[model samples]
Target chain A: MKKYTYTEKKDTRSGFGAGLHEAGKKNENVVALCADLVGSLKMEAFIKDFPERFTQVGIAEANMIGIAAGMTIGGKIPYTGTFANFSTGRVYDQIRQSVAYSNKNVKICASHAGLTLGEDGATHQILEDIGLMKMLPGMVVINPCDYNQTKAATIAIADYEGPVYLRFGRPTVPVFTDPDQKFEIGKAWMVNEGKDVTIIATGHLVWEAIEAGEQLAEMGIDAEIINIHTIKPLDEEAILKSVQKTGCVVTAEEHNKYGGLGESVARLLATTQPTPQEFVAVNDSFGESGTPNQLMEKYGLTDKDIVKAVQRVLERK
Target chain B: MKHTTEELEEIASQIRRDIVRMVHGCQSGHPGGSLGCADFFTALYFEVMHHSTDFTMDGKGEDLFFLSNGHISPVWYSTLARAGYFEASELATFRKLDSRLQGHPTTHEHLPGVRIASGSLGQGMSVAIGAALAKKLNNDKAIVFSLHGDGELQEGQNWEAAMFAPFNKVDNLICTVDFNGQQIDGPTEKVLSLDNLQAKFEAFGWHVIVSNGNSMEEIVKTLQYAVSLTGKGKPILNLMSTQMGYGVDFMMGSHKWHGVAPNDEQLKLALDQLKETLGDY
Candidate 1:
């Protein structure tokens, strides 16, 4: 496996804030609405830089979504900020009818997604947002791996011209990807080149996949790592090409084992290639109040879990 | 088009006729609220709004209107067609598969004059506020208008939007609640009480106006007054009262006709009562 290192750790939400600030600078039409989570969502920079272009929606997520959708009527690109739970579950009908169905250019930026939301437990840690957003037609679902990619995604979706769900985490993780990396929607990044096993991961699990690749290398096993950032318009070509080369695959994500990136990959493989696959995901269960690291380990979503999944898929192969 | 009250009333009768015919043709739809809202729709489309006949999704340089009570799509479809957004003949295709005029209003079909999908009640208020905010941001000077059913206010989201608009000083929005006192289940008072609605809106810091929705002249006057109240650092609300099924005697004063299309005999009675001054589909 190729050696990877990072000098610092950063929360992905700050990346979103930085990206939003950059987007606002580049385009005056980039407007933002937040349901009173300015600090939590790391949107202070954007709000401070562009106060007139930002709105404090006072904890009304549904209203924020509708307002964003309506703002698109006059060529304004609106981005809504809220927790993953409130962003997707609390206002799903509004997002569906106002944003997705209307084909409005609205970016739904969700912070503190998945189990990494920690201490807040199941109510706040939304494991089903990926499913909810991906099922909607014309919605582009993105779950960036790190701070750099999350910021890039936040900036990229502004120019995409449709509804997009950008999911990020609260925990500060290693900033592995390049600072100036160009983020492309629906495109997978090949993190490492190998031929024995293909490990496809998204969000925080991408880092775990890298660790798993390094571990498998110690056992003289070569692992191919691919980071899938965009979940909706899944990078099927990249997945199929990598899976065909490896002849087996392990899919990982910080989401429910059902209706997530794993299922999306399984669907692609089942129909097109019928490759052996194993999922490194949380079994159908709610998360509990624990520290982020403890929860990731307790829920079996670590590098060891990915390594095990890769081994299991190899057995099936 | 600054039409006279008589000319607008003439158009209202035609719109009502179209409402009944559009519902009857499909043998399904809401006719009561559409009939009740006919005069107001006619007044807004023909006289009150500074909109365009040529259709575009971005109503940037012109006033925009949204239908929160989207089940009354017949009235809007007729108004949009008669106002030259599309052919009046297209009204016949209402509720048909692949038709732009869905059972409720939608922008999915790329329907002109509709910027958002409504029918899931209590959503349009916020959408209208957002559009109004957009107009203010663009410095377009054009206002955003929206209509809602009184019963629709029972939806909690409308209250959220109601609070948001005035708090944010979304002054370029004019939202009117059809105070018809009816929903699909029964009279709104029985279904769910909206006690002292005027006081509720006033408490939200909106400039409230009351109008007779059935009267073309009253609708025109009240809507004009509502427009004059804009840009005053507050959103305006018009609580316009109208009888359900206003023109047809049998359907009037009952919630049964709220979503029911007229049977043949009832359709005949309704057509006789509403004289079609403009050609029908």
Candidate 2:
């Protein structure tokens, strides 16, 4: 296993804010809209710098989506910021008709996704956003791992034409990836390569997978870890190649087991190569109010959970 | 480019003919709203708006129009064809397989005049306001116009957009509500009463204008006045009143024809009522 460590920790939303400001500077047409969570979404810098291009939609997520879709008509790349719950489930029809069905160039940037949203509980923590977003035609579903990847994704989606749902989290996590890495829309990042077992993860679970990989290495089990950021356009080639080499897989994500990265990987394997797989995610159950770490542990989405899933899958293999 | 009231009315008659013919050909469509808004569509496209026949998605230098009440697409398709956005012969393919003229307005098929897909109600106002904001950003003097059904305001998103435009000072948008008082189920009052619409809009900080939508002269005058009201620091809303079926005697003022196609005899009667001044497609 490759030794991975981060001396600093940062929330992914701040990265989104930094990336938005950078994207705005690079392209004059990039505009940001927020639904009354400017500070929570870490969009104050972009708003302060480009006051004229920013719109404060005042808690109206549906209107924000419609406005973003409309902004795309005149060549403006609008990024709408809100909680993951409000961004998808609350405004699915608006996104479907105005953005996806129309094929508009709008980036729906959602923060505070999944159990990581913490004390806000199930209402704010959206475990099914991945499924809601991926089901829409022409929608690119992206869940970046950490601060650096989130920033890169925020900037990268500005240039990609069409509708994109960029999902990130609120909790501060390890900043392990390269600060200057180029974010690809549909490409998977190979975190660590080993032939014994494959561990696929996304969003906050990527860091956990890395931790689990280190633990697995100490137990004399070589594991191949793959970071799948883009879930909709799943990097089938990368996944198939890694799974074929390992013959077993463990999928981890801070989402429901039914509709997150785990299901996507399982479906891919079942169709292409049929590999033994274990999911380290919340079962089909809503989360309760607790600290991020506590909720993650209680819901079976931690490094230990990934290690256990990997061990279980290895037994199956 | 200025058309006389008589000429606009003649063109509207032709549009009404096209609407009924297109609906009858498809055997499935909403003709009541289409027939009701024919004159308004004719007046706006032919006389009031400063637009180009060659359509582009980024309508930067030209006035943009979005049909929020997309169930009435037949009127818009005819208006677009008559305004030379596309060939008039394409109207025959309305609602047919692989045709750009979908059941509702959509940009999915690369339709020349459509910039956004809209069949879901209460979404057009936000889109119009956003487009108007974009015009302000680009420093374009062009205005954005949108039309909505009266019953469509039942969706909560409309109020969200309605509250947004005024507070944000989106002054370059001119939205009109087809105040026909009729919907698919029944009259709007029975379905859901939009109590005191003028007061509602006025309270929302919009310059409200009321006009008879079926009359070409009134629609033209109202639109011109609405255009003059732009850039004055308020979004304008026009409540244009029209009968559900304006021309055909049997269907006039009734909601039964809202989404029903006319049969052979009914089509002949509708054609007899509407004069084909510019000739049928």
Proportion of native contacts kept per candidate: 0.80, 0.81
Q: Which stretches of candidate 1 lie over 4 Å from their true place?
A: none
Across A1-317, the per-residue lDDT of candidate 1 in tens digits comes to 89999999999999999999999999999999999899999888888999999998897898899999899989999999999999999999999998998899999999999999999899999998999999999999999999999999999998898999999999999999999999999999999999999999999999999999999999989999999999989999999999989999999999999889999999999999999999988899999899999999999999999988888888998
Across residues A1-317, which tens digit of lDDT does each residue of candidate 2 receive? 99999999999998999999999999999999999999989998888889999999998999999999888878899999999999999999999999999999999999999998999899999999999989899999999999999999999998899999999999999999999999999999999999999999999999999999999999999999999999989999999999889999999888888888888888898888999999998899999999999999999999999999988999999
Candidate 2 - CAPRI tier? high
* Best model number under lDDT: 2
Candidate 2's residue-wise lDDT over B1-281, tens digit each?
49888998899899989999999999999989998998899888889899998888999889999888889999999999998999999999999999999999999998899999999888998999889889899999999999999999998999999999988889999999999999888998998999899999999988899889988878888999999999999999999999988888898999999999999999999899888898899
lDDT: worst 10-residue window of model 1 chain B: B1-10
- TM-score of chain A in every predicted structure: 0.99, 0.99
TM-scores, all candidates, are: 0.99, 0.99
lDDT of 1 at A18: 94
Model 2's C-alpha root-mean-square deviation from the true structure amounts to 0.9
